[model samples]
Target: MPTLLRLHTDRPGHGSGLRLAASGEIDLSNVDDLKSALADAVAEIGSSGEELVVDLAEVEYVDSAAINVLSAYADAIHRIVVHPYLLSTLRVSGVTELVTVDPVQQ
Candidate 1:
């Protein structure tokens, strides 16, 4: 299988908040790309430090590197949108407080 990870940012309300929609697998192979994508978004946010939401609805698998990326950005993020299966991993990883999984959205 091809190792692919996709990340894009959505600025709702014309710059009020950033929604990072990530899909595919996030493992060591694409960790750097993931970080770069996030860094770009943060740079785009400018100095206002607006709220950000990470939408991971299409993500089916993740590795430690991905978790680390999330950890690094936890402070900048308002919440994380994830899938049910990934919830336990985030919880056990002790990041449940910043993550949210909506059944309807999933």
Candidate 2:
């Protein structure tokens, strides 16, 4: 069975910045969840100019669609926290060039 993607949005207090953390696999099957979450996060942080921190540490996998969605929001995103396993994928996909990609600290 495929693991359904889960998204958690939060703001780490005043002037900290907005964040969207995603867990589980992010393939085409559940890419919309990521898109919607990003859109909602962006809308919620409207006019504040706060950077969006995308935490994908728990994400097990991601397809091109998922990368596309992240790329689409590169300007709004401050950094992306991903597992070491996914770092190469992000690098190959050019996501690392578009935005900061950090490996989750063990």
Candidate 3:
């Protein structure tokens, strides 16, 4: 059996940002979970002025379904930092402009 999809979220205090840490694969099998998580994150950020930061460092894979969900929103400024590997995939898919890609320090 495949490992279950897991997403961890952290919403800091006032003036702090929101962090969504995702692990495991996000394919057709578990894209919905990711979508739900993202939706909740968006809702939380929308209510508060806090930004969003998604850490995809442990995400082994992502498919079009996951990509489509992410493409729907225009995140707040300085929000949404995608992992380097995920950033490459997003760039190739032409959705890099939709989210901010933060470079990982070596």
Candidate 4:
């Protein structure tokens, strides 16, 4: 079975900042992909104090398992941008307390 989540990573030319754009549905079945992507991003950023910008504006859904993955990398993540509807879930899951969560501007 294929995972429903898709992750895209981008590194800026000159800083410790990196961006990861995720789309599709995130659930337990495919949570590993999210973890792997974050892990790779962290490795790339190395000891430079990686600050990640997660663009989840196109993400339609995310389950608890996916939230856990994001939390695991909270220290490395600078912010997470998601569709407005997903805000509550991330907040209720305590992700908002760990990192910045913003709604994508129209």
> Which residue pairs in candidate 4 collide?
none
| Clashes per model (N, Cα, C within 3 A) | 0, 0, 0, 0
Error of 4 at 100 (Å): 0.6
Minimum summed lDDT over a 10-residue window in model 3 is located at 74-83
Better of 1 and 3 by lDDT: 1
Off by over 4 Å in 4: 1-3, 12-16
Deviation of model 4 at 71, angstroms? 1.1
Q: List TM-score per model, in order.
A: 0.84, 0.93, 0.80, 0.90
lDDT measured at residue 106 in model 2 versus the true structure, 0 to 100: 100
Model 3, range 1-106, lDDT digits (tens) per residue?
5446789898656667888888888888888887888788888878666777776777878888877767765454344456577777888876668767665554
lDDT of 1 at 100: 49
**Candidate 4 accuracy as lDDT:** 0.89
For model 2, state the Cα shift of residue 62 in Å: 0.4
Write the residue-wise lDDT of candidate 1 on 21-55 in tens digits.
88999999888888888788777765787877778
Candidate 3: stretches off by over 4 Å: 1-3, 12-14, 76-78
| Index of the highest-TM-score prediction | 2
Task: Give the deviation of candidate 3 from the true structure as CA RMSD.
Answer: 2.4
